[model samples]
Target chain A: MESAIDTHLTACPRTISRRVPDAYQPPFPMFVGRADETLHQVTMAYLGVQYRDGGQRTAALAAVAEIVGTFDIADGPAHNDITRHTDKEGYVNLIVVGYWRDPAAFCRWLRSPDVNGWWDSPERLSGELGYFREIVSPRAEQFETLYAFTDNLPGVGAVMDDISGEINEHAYWGSMRERFPLSQTDWMESSGELVVVTGNPADGGRVVVQGHDNIALIRSGQDWREAGPEERALYLEEIQPTLQAGMDFLRDNGETVGCYSNRLVQNIDLDGNLLDETYNIGHWRSLEKLERWAESHPTHLRIFTTFFKVVADLDKLRLYHEVSVSDGANQIFEYLNCHPSTGMMRDAKVMASR
Target chain B: MESAIDTHLTACPRTISRRVPDAYQPPFPMFVGRADETLHQVTMAYLGVQYRDGGQRTAALAAVAEIVGTFDIADGPAHNDITRHTDKEGYVNLIVVGYWRDPAAFCRWLRSPDVNGWWDSPERLSGELGYFREIVSPRAEQFETLYAFTDNLPGVGAVMDDISGEINEHAYWGSMRERFPLSQTDWMESSGELVVVTGNPADGGRVVVQGHDNIALIRSGQDWREAGPEERALYLEEIQPTLQAGMDFLRDNGETVGCYSNRLVQNIDLDGNLLDETYNIGHWRSLEKLERWAESHPTHLRIFTTFFKVVADLDKLRLYHEVSVSDGANQIFEYLNCHPSTGMMRDAKVMASR
Candidate 1:
């Protein structure tokens, strides 16, 4: 690893190869260990419901929540969280997020009698409440994770063993792509176009959107709960502005830059109290597009420079991100009685079942 | 109406009664017409799914989207928008937001052969994808809508008839509460505690959180797409700063001021293009709590004053909000295979089913 860093000192900034110094150390820790071939698959699952009129909302959710609480540690996800959010449509949605290092384990848990039986029950479709489960499984090579503080972890981090100390391939342009193990052998280009699987959402029918290859998903997060007043002020006043600007650029004009959709959200407690945490979740057309934006975009440049300038003064402020490139075959887009602009329904062509 | 406004000139600022000049017109149009008792109920529906690994995601979503597209105008929501966002748990979520002025219409649509048949099909539980529907129906008196522009209506506004000329109720504190017709006869106080209907989420069982009455839901939005460069700069530089500060206060310390949860999110197009729109959706314990914050809090005052100060220069910028206070029995929270912090699952007591 040391020799590799030395050899890449002259690596082109435009190229995929990474350049780093022997004594270089990132201000934060990151995830590593692709060498462990056995740990190659990771899966995430969300089980949720949407309801209103109070007639059956409470009863319906209780039925589902009860089932989730019955799984044993061995057969269940590594970690789980229950959250609620009001969708843009004004419905309060309750979601249970579960993570598994092994997709097979997730399958087993889903196949369990109690789980399958509840889903199979006719009560689920009794017009009382709406229920759903969404899951994603990605190979180890398809994803990467980084962290600032090891204390409070999220998503895959909650299931992973540990985070690495100062690593060589970060803090520079294109480091996000350089960190991806898949990027080593694959350019992660998107192939094909989005195809709608059913009728049009605008006209009201079952709609499914099929995306192209090598789509990218990113979760970049910040945590300042442990920050002192000074560090907190520095983050809120200095670091946040540039970060928000970059995010705003992506949210408003990302398509022009290879990005798809971006959302900046604050994490709150179940009772609705806001926590000192926030994150940006987005989807990109391809990993290369994301890389291009991060490498050359002025918005990202400002965020990059601001971080470096205030790195020393920032303590107890954790900044980390996870990036993954998934095959088109591994995506899902669906809607029912939804607005026309929901998901990829409007972007993709309707599928011809013929 | 003129006499009513004049008579309330000395009305307590902290009370629900509104006071405004007869000639004073708001810069933006607002929704009115409580006199028409026929339009008493409003319903919002969210039919969505969560999926990943590519195998069932696109297919499942397409299936659902097709069903939504089949609804006829008279039997369907007045308007719809298909949107997608990545959930905090790492799964991509696609949702169709639908609105109906009559809950009966929503029920008729949901019970339609195509809709119910599709939902009841055994394939729904075939482990291909997770599906759900979340709906909220509130009487006209319990909900209020305000819009800056009639052209870009959202949520209930999309289904509403026409916007009214300058209304006398806005631009002051406590105006939000006063806008709700329900406030005239009811204080809109919360009545019950959240009771978990099922098992514990931490232990991997089904969990349902039943909430109390008068849970306040507010959606505040901003649209600056029509603004020119100067107006945009004023919003981005001067207005946005104070607005965000106020939102931040609610997000981080909302519990102290009656907020339950607050999420600041950006609206995006189907292709993931960032729209020139953003909104903050929040849950509050009670209407009074929210009223107190908007009335006396310095943070809100800053937002109010800032908006008034720049109202003239902000020609094309649009600002709007919808506030609804619902009975606790109307609220539904359910979790499946989720983490403890997913929703009210962590805060409520577990149901002791005898």
Candidate 2:
């Protein structure tokens, strides 16, 4: 009952009229897109680790590979990237991300009865490393994905079962949260403005965030291919400064954006090797506050205007950004370890009775 | 209606009263003592920060003081401490912890007409600071508190409103979750064992966690009075090594005790000055696994037996410990500023979308 072309689509991040690789058994058929409209929930999972030892890194990598190798349910697809770095006083980490088109399939896989027993069992983790896993099931429009430059899908986009055919749409078709189907709160209109731009933080202040109604933005971009000198200069002279200034503003003046926490991370592979891809994760008390920082904050406006020019003029880079707006409730953070930067900890009610 | 003996509980870290503070005011008379025996909900709040600049820190500190000053009610009490610390990778943090014996009163204050007008206003946060506030309203037995040696209640104890009069009990009178009213999953009988003698980790291996149902133990103790040379030696030679080994074991080998994360924290003041108090926090898959490590893990058993001996023989040390147990469902974490040592963020679902 199935078309032969569907065979090639199995385990493929992208499905064009292209030939398929001879040998690729995905950890799971994460997103075969065989489901109908009855599906309402989709879940994504990310598991990552940073090996502390040069030798253990290999063992840990192999352990992850083994787990993936044994994983046969591709109700979705996954992405592997070299990310994260740290120092002596801190730590470095590597991460693996998985996406599922249907929440039921994810639940089925998670509760796969007896399958993937190692994962559900405590034995999957070894004493020699640090690891983390995140799971989220977002309803329609609750989560969105976009890709540019290449014809291929990556990260969460790959795991989407396209019964909805939404993946092929242009990445820039919508603005912020409106890019998805629902979440119409402020989609028709935008809020926030840039206040001022001074010198670098060590010299003077740059941007500030105020208000509790906030929005958080996360973005990752890297040179997909070789860039011309103009592209290089554009990034160096324009992009880098904006990013650094925004980050400095957050660190030096945490309250300016109603920003609670901000982190800029360098990506890494299982080998503990660094990559060009980076992620900026931050929490603002509200969307209006964050928009104000981006719109009027001289520092952010400059970056956005300049960066838009790059997007208009260039094709050598692939970029993606996501915005998740929260009213500050309906979310919980557990502190396995507490520190100066623990999330939502100021609001924590119970301490782990150790 | 007021008692003549009512007096102010000053900056005293430890105050035993034949009396209560006079000038002190809490945001609410959170524990009105009128709630029925059926009433079980209890809440606690902690607000903490790390000042960046001398000026900003001063301003931020002043802002907090003003807020607390205007609170003007205390059916239940609260404790304010200058406790927190920082490092090169971490910014300084100042914390104030409060307890509420009655959730209704706290809610009434939070929702009171013009009662807490200043707190609800978004404009209150100027965006030039780093601040966090945690609000927890756990059901009865969902939370518990204890005190020993010290005269005045601290942290969660201060806000209890004293109807139960449990704060005056010995710190070690109850086991695990039973310290409170109703959490009795496995409390009547104890689990785990304590063995003697151990190799030191510095030379080689000492203790390790190997089971899945283990429970984690966290405690902090500081000498109330000056410790003699013998006391120092007991800490340095006997206690310190064992505690360090247990922590190192968890950090270096995450799964050994069915443990995922463990942190040893030293307390500091508002100015980022150090205090003798400290805290240990950890996450374990189950209580059985944590118990195995505590009773039999070479590193912990040695430390425990010796530490217990000290508890029996000495009164110079004021000690306390707490542990919280959870499943993947009830807990969620958001990563803002990331480091290698951040929480088990692999399970993190939402990163800020910019």
Candidate 3:
């Protein structure tokens, strides 16, 4: 029996030549995996188009919907979920991420003739309407899991629910499926010791945990270059205790499924000037673990108390947290899987463990 | 006696310190125009933030409501005429391009302390929660009219009518102007001639009928290196004959209020890639004049026929139109304007005309 992929190809013969060389060829094989079992990291970027005339509003909207739809249809059975982001402003952005059982599944969808046909459609063409433009980049990085806890193995929805709940309230959650799927790869840079765990198999979804240890260093300041060495040292010293406390809390908390204590030294764009600095990013198995550490853990509580006090007088600080769900993958191609921004960062933390 | 400006300065002392540097200052002044002759432009850029999360559905619907509000605001003070255009998709491309009389009065309500307080409120800062980054660029361009029709001018009702008609059929245009007395600017550019009509009575709300020959050539795109000589020639040839025909039609038809012809061009991305290259943009004074030209005149008929043929085989094309009342100024500022993808092109067209 012919598969849906085969049928789609037969129905829509590829009529347009590839704008990029070897466009018809799959960029890479697709990888599918069970929710808790698959460990993948993804990244993505988005661009939006605005038009000059209000009358073309419908046409512009149609064009965008069609483009996204094309990608969704091409990903095939391996496709897991996709989410679009837009502000009532004339802007549209979408995120596609997920896990697939194998790489070939993704490749079939990416190289299928139906995907090509959608882009070549004259009715939904971008050039004729001159209303919108978009670019999507998806890539996968391999990750090593330290621990995972789930009642029924692991599925996309469970991971997504955990991640989404950890982050701020967002409106586009359930519909992410049917859009894209997740995949894995071996390409990545080993930076620090990281650990990952997924837990809570009975009542709720599993928790995937990753931890990193003995990282670089970081300090917070309104402008780092302008700071004296003493100030920078003091800032670092002030925050170190808090981080240590957090680590200790993680060690003690039963709900804690994952913990990471690593340093991220990155550049800061301060009014056009580039400043180098470092900060800590970590993940826990659940909000309960994070809250327990924050509220009751002695070391963690003390560190945060001091850090907050110091930054209270300062204009800017480096510390930030991103809670996210594994919404799946956004497949720009087979080798690439674009994860949501917050979730991608967390996945990065997992990669650091290896 | 102190004016309201003085009272405002005294009341909102924080505006001085929070004001961004001059370089970051908006290119145009901010003020509410009176109902009879007010022009306002609100430009928003949603590239970065809107795409960050699952934002597409919420953002798109919100944009539709926002455009509708702008049209509703214009309906006040018996300003019953309006016009707008959207791209092939539902993204709002442009709104508000006509005429009004009492911009000062309109401004009074727009800048009321109640509204100002909401924007200034600590809990609800204007930019904090929205998907699109916004730049409210308002300007007062000067125009002297030489023609007049009935005192009927562009307003919210007219905008609502058009929007309702479009929405009923397409679902995109239906809610553009449900609220009243709001305004925004849309900027776009075209590789066409500059036609400026000046030196008429600036006081009347209606179009002036006398200054037909007072056209000015501000700048031409023919000198640009990126545009080739053949393309330039083609552009000029295409527009000149149509312009002449329009002029003749205005001269012959007693019902003609005013006439102007413009050529719309594609927008370019930050990396300088041309986007949306298929749409053709032209401006007309009134729908009646356009209809008459299309119906009886040979030159206009031929020009339009050629245009249709050129776009016939294309997959899809979006043609947008807006009729607005102007306060003799390009109400929206281009540089500080947000929706840069399309707004930049619109600005280019205005500069070419200048």
Docking class of 1: incorrect
Give candidate 3's fnat, 2 decimals.
0.00
lDDT of 1 by residue, A240-323 (tens): 887788888876676576676565656644444567877776678777667656644545655666665666555688887877
Q: Give lDDT tens digits, candidate 3, residues A1-354.
A: 111111111223332211111111211111122223242332221212223344644554554454445545644433222333221223332323333444455456546777545433553322424221111222221211100121211222222212211111111111011012211111111123323333221211222333232121111112234446655665557765456455544433323333322222223221212243433333333222333234333454355445434543442333332222222232121101111122212332333343
lDDT (tens digit, per residue) of candidate 3 on B196-305: 12211222111112111111111011111233555444434764466455444443342332234232223333222444322223333322233323333445444434
Candidate 3, residue A323: the lDDT equals: 27
Candidate whose lDDT is highest: 1
For model 1, report DockQ. Answer: 0.01
Give all candidates' CA lDDT scores: 0.62, 0.42, 0.27
Q: At residue A21, what lDDT does model 2 achieve?
A: 16
* Chain B fold agreement for model 1, TM-score: 0.75
The CA-based lDDT of model 2 is what?
A: 0.42
What TM-score would every model get versus the actual structure?
0.43, 0.35, 0.19
Question: lDDT per residue, candidate 2, A233-282, as tens digits?
Answer: 66667687777787667644656545555556666554546665565555
Off by over 4 Å in 3: A1-354, B1-54, B63-101, B113-330, B334-339, B344-354
**Candidate 1 deviant stretches above 4 angstroms:** A1-16, A19-36, A46-74, A82-95, A113-134, A198-200, A203-207, A240-256, A270-273, A296-299, A332-340, A344-346, A352-354, B1-354
Worst 10 residues of 2 chain A by lDDT: A23-32
